[model samples]
Target: MFVSRKSIWGHTGKVMALALTLALNGACGDDDDDEGGGDNKPGDSVKVTGKVTYDFVPAVYSTATRAGTLAFSQVTKKPVRGAVIQVRQGNTILSNATTDDQGNYEITYKVPSSGSLTIVALAKTTTPSIQVEDNTDGDAVWGVGTSLPSNAKTRDMHAGHGWTGGAYNAEQRFAAPFAILDSMYTAARAFMNVRPVQFPELKVNWSPNNVPGAGEKDDGNIGTSHFSPSDNEIYILGKDGVDTDEFDSHVIVHEWGHYFESNLSRSDSPGGPHGAGDVLDPRLSFGEGYGNALAAIILPESMYVDTVWSQRTGALAAFGFDAETAPSPSDDPEPGVFSESSVMRILYDLYDSGSNESAYDNVSFGLGTFYDVLTGPQKATDALTTLGSFVNGLKAQSGVNTSAVHALLAHYRVGAVTSDFGDGDTSLRAIYTPVASVPYNTNVTLTGGVEANKRQQNQYFVFTGTGRTMNISVSNLSEDVDVEVYRRGTVVAAGYLSGTSPESVTFSSQANTQYVLVVTGYKEADGVYGASVSITSP
Candidate 1:
């Protein structure tokens, strides 16, 4: 895997030539207020307060769909009943029914598109589904490959949950996500020397309420945040992808892998570009490949298919981790669980080699050059274990989690990239003054140097306590390194980006613990430049 950072494109010609066959169920949604040409500008959100009708179609493309309907009498909490309704799709109408005094209503929405579709119950007044997603959500659940469940609430889905980020430490208790921060920080230390990634803060989500057929993100569930120029909520999907317990818990850690690398700007690099002869970014690919592989390495017993197969009889003994090892169950999903072609096999091979390529399976192979940059943690990233820690230090030092993986690779731990990786943490990165101290309520601005001519980027810091609202000046700066601060990761305040250099970015802490400062990168024609971090919080 390490030999002069070989040219990745040389093998670009082999589009489908995967070293392993475990890549599974290869992997959208919309809101239409109104379709128009010069159109009636539909309100950002229309209050469809009237009775809305719908039907549930059996398949995405099936014509013979079932029809049903519910009528709503009131929209507010206290209920009203006795109303009629009908399901409609374009010119087609499915049914007309009445509500039975209890205000309970129902109607199926025809499969409008291949993505997640919402079915709203519109009436004079009603409690419509906030947003209902189709069955095709989690790969494992969607692939149940069976009839639809009669009701949504009663069903259970499984997903990985035991994960604790770059640090393979501790048991996860979903109720309090912040509990994992210490272990995650430790992992960041170990990760700094090797891979390049940023650790924002540690958070967890036990159940990702709704996601199926694969589009669901394990990025992080809703618990806490560090910074944001965008969204700051971490999302974690539950066991079976349904956000529930009771199913095999294999998916928990795999998604945590996503959250691990997804802390900054971009979550992954490009896959080999199609026809256009473009090369995919490896930064993006490594997380998925590595996360899945990492999950397998840490999975607890009770979860393995072999465990189940073996208990039933020696028959399942044949099925193990790969085709060469595992015993396949007839009930197992496609691509037999124990084959050399399994995800288990590819992940094992990649880790066994200690970042060596001949051993790099399908996913990691795609992450090429990105593998080189931060062989360890530095000033920017959160520290982690061994290789994991080195990568953390590199991120914390470089301080621009927003840059593309390739751009971060350019740093060599001399810098770190800050990115929210769309964890919805828009303020994921920010710049700070590294000041020795600051006055409690004084509005102080700080200045720091970013590499010359590097792409524009920002960093965030927070100051919260009694009644201290910090004012920031971004109008003038030594350079255009993006910087700001947040309260609960919300963009309610500002700091360095305003242009006035002062003692420090000022803010008061509500809890008076430690406020976070983040720095991120932006895409410029050449690429991204590194940003630094500093702060003034008391």
Candidate 2:
């Protein structure tokens, strides 16, 4: 997994293999002139207005296909929404304004020089969104971008260049993509000691009130933000209010963490809504929890913050809450396979040398150790990748003592995690239904999806398969049930349906191998389902 430093640069091809998935199109309308012009007298300021759009080609990354292709014919003029813009002269700062709905900005600033003042639009400081008076002209959200110093010289004095480069760390509000790039830099900088793997130009798409796709309708009001591994694109919400995530450095880095995992390692996250405290699917627990930990690792700050801002009128330009608090693993009385908070705490503990307060966090494994396991045995294992799997892999390393790591996991009530599948946990007495194991050629009756076991309705069992064709079947007596068989964590076969008919699958399995069967509801009840297994040899 640890490629030679020189060969690591070639890893970008695998990272950018996917095409962009979303296609965004914006039609810029004619702008209305402001009535009150600036007072052009001596020492008086002039009103300046400009438009902001990305002057680059848009590429597509597809999640379904895990491929990326250039959308050469597609329009590239993407209007940045809710970005703060400012006007400055020399060392003196003037007025600031947020882009309006149409990516246009107007700021009134006093003249700085005596003869001619060269006013420059600095990205991200303080700003205000546009105003709508009657409804004569169409409304559009303003796009923000920071002009680099090299690009700053291209600004037109007379006509005023519509765009320029001026990216600064503090000016993330003006250039949201800069924050994402900065997050990548922070992550890459840490790995620079070993010469980190190279990555392609990650395509990022952002706008107000839009999902990943061009015309995909958002059912929920909460804006969607994600990084498509197949597409190699990080989609962000530039919308106003609680939906914005660009300025939230933690949120940006968290999404980028997924990109890193999918490229540099492997992530088996089933992909769903996973909160820090929620009892989640094991896959979701590790995926979301790992991301949360990476954000803190990259920033190394006391707290992780996710912010939401207002595009319209308000005293507060943006408001945010912390993503991480002090390590409180004991707060969650019932920590299980679903707790991302526990996963994050364990990961942070493994890598952190500074957090010496907690006995659980006494080990200082460092990020290199974390990276080694993630890219090595954790990835090679066929077992269900979870917190337990990560711990198991970490212990297998040469330098680390397995007992010390197990002590840390036990301190957090993670249980005696022996393997990746969490084989020894007995906490299911109050949570999940009792698991019933059936030998080959045996039948077992299982009930799932009952209201009492909503979160833990899925039933799991183990079957020993000799070197032969193994047939596993599930028949719903009165309810609909589905079945999935796993050799370790790899799904060998799965069936899902909505009827009472039996769903079955047969596949050739290895000799004396342990196979896991998972039975759950399809769309209806999984009540009183009968499951049977048969093995046929030549």
Candidate closest to the true structure, highest lDDT: 2
- Candidate 1 local lDDT, 1-538, one digit each (tens): 1112122223221111110110121110011222222311222211112221111111011112211111112112222233233333322333334334343444443333322212212121111111111111221110010011112211111111232432211222111121122122223333443544445532232333322223323333322211111233223323221223112222344444444444532231222211111111122223333444454444422122211112343221112222112332421232211111222333343233234333212222212223333232311322111122223333343332324322322221212223322111111122232323433222233322322211123333333343444333333333343443443223334443322343134454454433434333323334433333433232
Per-candidate Cα lDDT values, in order, are 0.27, 0.50
Best by the TM-score measure: 2
For residues 168-257, what per-residue lDDT tens digits would candidate 2 score against the true structure?
A: 122122334433433455565565445455644443444444432334323212236776655554566654443545545667778878
After superposing candidate 2 on the true structure, give the runs of residues whose Cα lies further than 4 Å from its correct spot.
1-174, 192-196, 199-201, 211-223, 229-232, 309-331, 423-455, 462-467, 486-490, 510-515, 522-538
Over 4 Å off, model 1: 1-256, 259-293, 296-433, 439-467, 476-508, 519-538
What alpha-carbon RMSD in Å does predicted model 1 have with respect to the real structure? 23.6
